[model samples]
Target: MDVFPDFDGMRGIGNLQSVAGALLMFALIIAVLMLIVCAIVWAIAAGTGNYQIATKSRNGVLVALGAAVLAGAGVTWLNWLIDLGSRL
Candidate 1:
């Protein structure tokens, strides 16, 4: 361990926050790409006249996205419920 630490020349919150914001942007980019790919595959499969096949494929994509959204909401709801119960 060095005796004296260098706190000098430290770039503060702005630099760290920018890096975190960039990571969030990357996550959004990945989500958008996934949505686009899912839509495209669904479209191609849908071109086939097999109604069941297309419906299942579309449903699969919707279910995946819905699960993500619902999972997020569920966590928030569970938190709220915990808070509500604790007050009772």
Candidate 2:
């Protein structure tokens, strides 16, 4: 048996999807911007011999990278889940 979601079974689903997509885009943009800013700051801090700020900026860069990755992976993960569900 095949199982699939009834995307049309509910009202406002299209709007919800649009909103979610917009949010995902916004998040990815912000994450990439933060990553760039953090990397620059990290380089500047390291050059200026500020170990404390360099460490913090490095952490910020890592967090931003994680956020971007998660945001991008969410779509792939969802699609995989839907495909798996449809095959069941």
Candidate 3:
């Protein structure tokens, strides 16, 4: 009696890989766009001597960068964690 049933038959699932790839591409594009926008805002605020706006824009840039980094690493990290858990 196997506690974890064999899932070998489900290896050839639907087009999930393609879908995940597309979504990741979309997220990267959006993150890049947001970064550009934040840069523009920061530049404008700096030129206008609006320290508050510049600060906010700087924060936005950091957040966008963090999001991009997380998005890129998320899948690999998740897979690693799952593998570790299975070994436990």
Best model per lDDT? 2
- Candidate 2 lDDT over residue span 3-39, tens digit each: 8788556666456566766788888899999999999
Query: Each model's C-alpha lDDT?
Result: 0.60, 0.85, 0.76
Give RMSD to native, each candidate.
10.8, 3.8, 3.6
- The sequence of per-residue lDDT tens digits that candidate 3 reaches over residues 1-88 is 6587565644533354456556766787788889889999999999999999999999999988888887677656655655565455
Question: Against the true structure, what is each candidate's TM-score?
Answer: 0.45, 0.76, 0.70
Error of 3 at 7 (Å): 4.4
| lDDT tens digits by residue: candidate 1, 1-88 | 6685454544454554455556555654555556566677778877866667667667767765665565455545655655564455
List residue ranges in candidate 2 displaced over 4 A. 1-8, 78-88
Candidate 3 runs further than 4 Å off: 1-7, 11-14, 75-88
Q: Point to the candidate with the largest TM-score.
A: 2
Task: Give residue 37's lDDT in candidate 2 (0 to 100).
Answer: 100
Clashing pairs in 3: none
By summed lDDT, the worst window of 10 consecutive residues in model 3 runs over 9-18
lDDT of 2 at 23: 82
Error of 1 at 84 (Å): 26
C-alpha lDDT (0 to 100) for residue 85 of candidate 2: 51
